[model samples]
Target: MSAAAAVLREEIGGQPAVWRALVARGAQVAEVAAALDALDPPLVRIAAHGTSDHAGIYATYLLRALRGWTVVRDSMSMPLYYGSPAARPGELAVGISQSGETPDVVAWLERAGREGATTLAITNGEGSSLARIADHVLAIGAGAERSIAATKTYTGTLAAIALLAGQLAGRGPQLADALVATADAADALLDGLDAAVAPVAAALARIDRMYLVARGIELATANEVALKLTEVCYLGAKAMSATAMAHGPVAALDADVPLWAIAAPDATLPAVAEAVRRARAAGAPVIASGPAAAALDGAAFALPVPVVPAEPLLSPLLSVLPGQAFAWALAGAKGIDAGAPRHLRKVTSAA
Candidate 1:
């Protein structure tokens, strides 16, 4: 195997170990929780780009669903380039960066701090640029994500966000326990990948474009998974919420355009099931994952995840594992290197 391909395979299977490592750093997680609780902000605003932005989206679902906080996933361009308005006093602004040196993210967090909002940084880098400015920082703790296409760091962000949300829900211990189980579930998912995911990967290898629809918190997973498809496999992929697909996006479905859906066992499952049923009826082959894997009945493919069901917010960590494997497998099927895709870098900073 090529070195790049080997690295991608190793990292894809290495996610479980990364999650366990983050849980081992209980003290650091507690410090982050203390800072968030102390702020007690009425609204949470976040700035990030790419995969980090998807991590913030998962956190947004948790804060809104579990704590009833108004969460905004900011585009960062407004404050960084457009001179947007300042944040209000009762607001908490968060900046997420794997490298912690993205100029736009740093600029946005600095701007929010100056506007009187408490700032927090979630990153993998220790004492990096974003960490220096923020009042509090939570390390993603994935440890040395060397590949251009991220696997462990993305799951690390999900786990870290789950830890924070669990603290807010007054179940820190329980959530930590759940995260340990999640890591085990991730291993089980990885163990079955070579056999269970090969056909699914073969099916997707020839496809040139696809759509991924995920409902509720799983929308976060859909976005990240879609990004992987494009980043490594060069599949023209678009991601949207289940509701958006039902409302109007469904018209685009056809036999030539497949839809990959995350049908997790959440309250949104009923809605997602209906959407998938309708899309399949409209001739769009659908691939589904999670406990509601049945939602993809008669789909071209279904990759079941071995997940220990937790709160809806925490399910993304498990569901995303299969997506990562599928991307790597698809890359292998197409004879391309997964670790280093064309025109991509491990740390991309436009500013």
Candidate 2:
């Protein structure tokens, strides 16, 4: 393997360990949860960019599904350009960044604290600026992700969110156990993943662009996968919920543009299967992943993943693995270094 591929693979392989370590640090997570509960925030606003933004999206779905909190993805531009809206007392403002030095995110969290909202930072950068500014910090503890494209840190962020949600919902012990299961499942999945994804990567390399579809919680997985393809493989990938695809984007499907569907065994599986059928009718080849992938009628390829039945919310942590593998494989096929995509930096300063 090339040096670039090796670096990316190491980061990808390290995800399970990072997740287990995050769960092991349960005391800090519980303390953060208690602080959040004390605020009893009626609403949550999250500020992040790129992959971190996708993690924020997952957190929106998670916080709602688990704690039934009103959550919104806060646009940092609002604070960086236009004046930030006055934060209501006891509102929760969260800033997610793999590296905590993102200027806009740091600024947003600092402003949030000044505006009387409780601020939190979920980041891998324990000593970075954003960590210092937030009222509470939930460190991802992924430890020095070397690849420009985030692998472990992204999943680490999801794990952190899961931990926080579990604590807030008073299911910390159960969720922790589920996360350990997820890590074990991830280890098994990673063992055979590259060989399984090689052929799919070859097919993907022939396509210039792709569309990814999912629903409910996996909607974030679709979006994150699209970002990975875009960053690592230089594809013009778009992601949307299955319902949204049917409403309009489905018309764009054709033989030339393939569709990747996250057909996980969840409440949204039926809708996603329907979308797969629609894509097939439109002559778009479909690649489906998740435990229910094989059951999705009309999928050209199925990548079945292990599922945590006890905690359905933890599905994203498992489902996104195949997507990450595919991106790395596609990058290798195209002779691009997955670790170092052009015009990208490890830490982006969006301010």
Candidate 3:
């Protein structure tokens, strides 16, 4: 094993013991809808655990776009110390906790319920405090998320949210097929990870910073990867919109910087491609991960995967893998402990 891999192995075995249950639970999108059905009207205001808020934000955006419902995306800040007091009454506050028992999340929802908001907990823990107090519960089934950085659980939440949105939109059958197919695609993508990891990590190691750029849903995945880079590898990486990168972030680019462009099969791919070109002109090394595997000039690494049809809303889930693998491999290369980040506790009690 590489030094980074040894660190990972020592910190977190190859698989989190939680994954078995999470995978099985991720298979329970049907149950998630049933729980949603039980609590109708006023919609869900989603809050996800800290460091994992991007998934919840993307999921909330997808829900609002698909169902025309009001969706509030709350951040889980200092899980035991900070809480949102602006939540309105009668709304279903959905808390997404991979650990189920994060003190702030559990306490917030418990308080939300007491204040007349129906609490629905989406978590891996069936017996967790949030689950117990929730008026309704939609378990994430992401199993045990052992790595201090979440991977499978984030994907599982995307899948669950997609299913929930489809059900609310009355497109259950189509969504069900899409969910199964997405899991298969994720599996296929995971199979190719070994080949993709080395070059991406090597390219990353050569540079001091990376700009993860993409459009629409993929932008959120970019942010997630950026977060992982900062948290796990302590790297200077930023995730930004393709358009925003041009307006300002692009100005900071230089030859040694690496830009990781996330390309989607959607209509926005052209804009994403052009952004990569602009970044390269600034002398930054570029890498693109997408369906076409279109070898742009200086594009040192490409992940080979088919462009399967996906809901525009769910595209982030597919695009997330390459970045996730990139961050994990980068963590290993730098000898950072993936299971535990420096000066960080799993849950926060300090404000």
Please, what are the lDDT tens digits per residue for candidate 3 over residues 43-152? 56677655446777777677777777777776445333564462567677888776677776777777777777777787767787778988867676655554566666
Worst 10 residues of 1 by lDDT: 305-314
Q: Can you give the lDDT of residue 308 in candidate 2?
A: 84
After superposing candidate 2 on the true structure, give the runs of residues whose Cα lies further than 4 Å from its correct spot: 84-86
Global lDDT of each candidate:
0.83, 0.89, 0.68
RMSD of 3: 4.0
Model 2, 1-351: lDDT tens digits are 678778998888889999999888999999999989888899999998888998998999889888989999977787678875735678999999889988888888888889889999999999999999889999999988888889899999999999999999999999999999999999999999999999988876778799999888888889999999999999999999888888888888999899999977767888998999999999999999976788788788888898788787898898999999999999989888888899987776555
Question: What's the true lDDT of residue 26 in model 1?
Answer: 74
Model 1, position 317, has a per-residue lDDT of 86
True-structure lDDT of candidate 2: 0.89
**For every candidate structure, what is the RMSD over all alpha carbons to the true structure, in angstroms?**
1.6, 1.3, 4.0
Of 2 and 3, the candidate ranking higher by TM-score: 2
Candidate 2 matches the true fold with a TM-score of: 0.97
lDDT leader: 2
Output the worst ten-in-a-row residue range by lDDT, candidate 3: 10-19
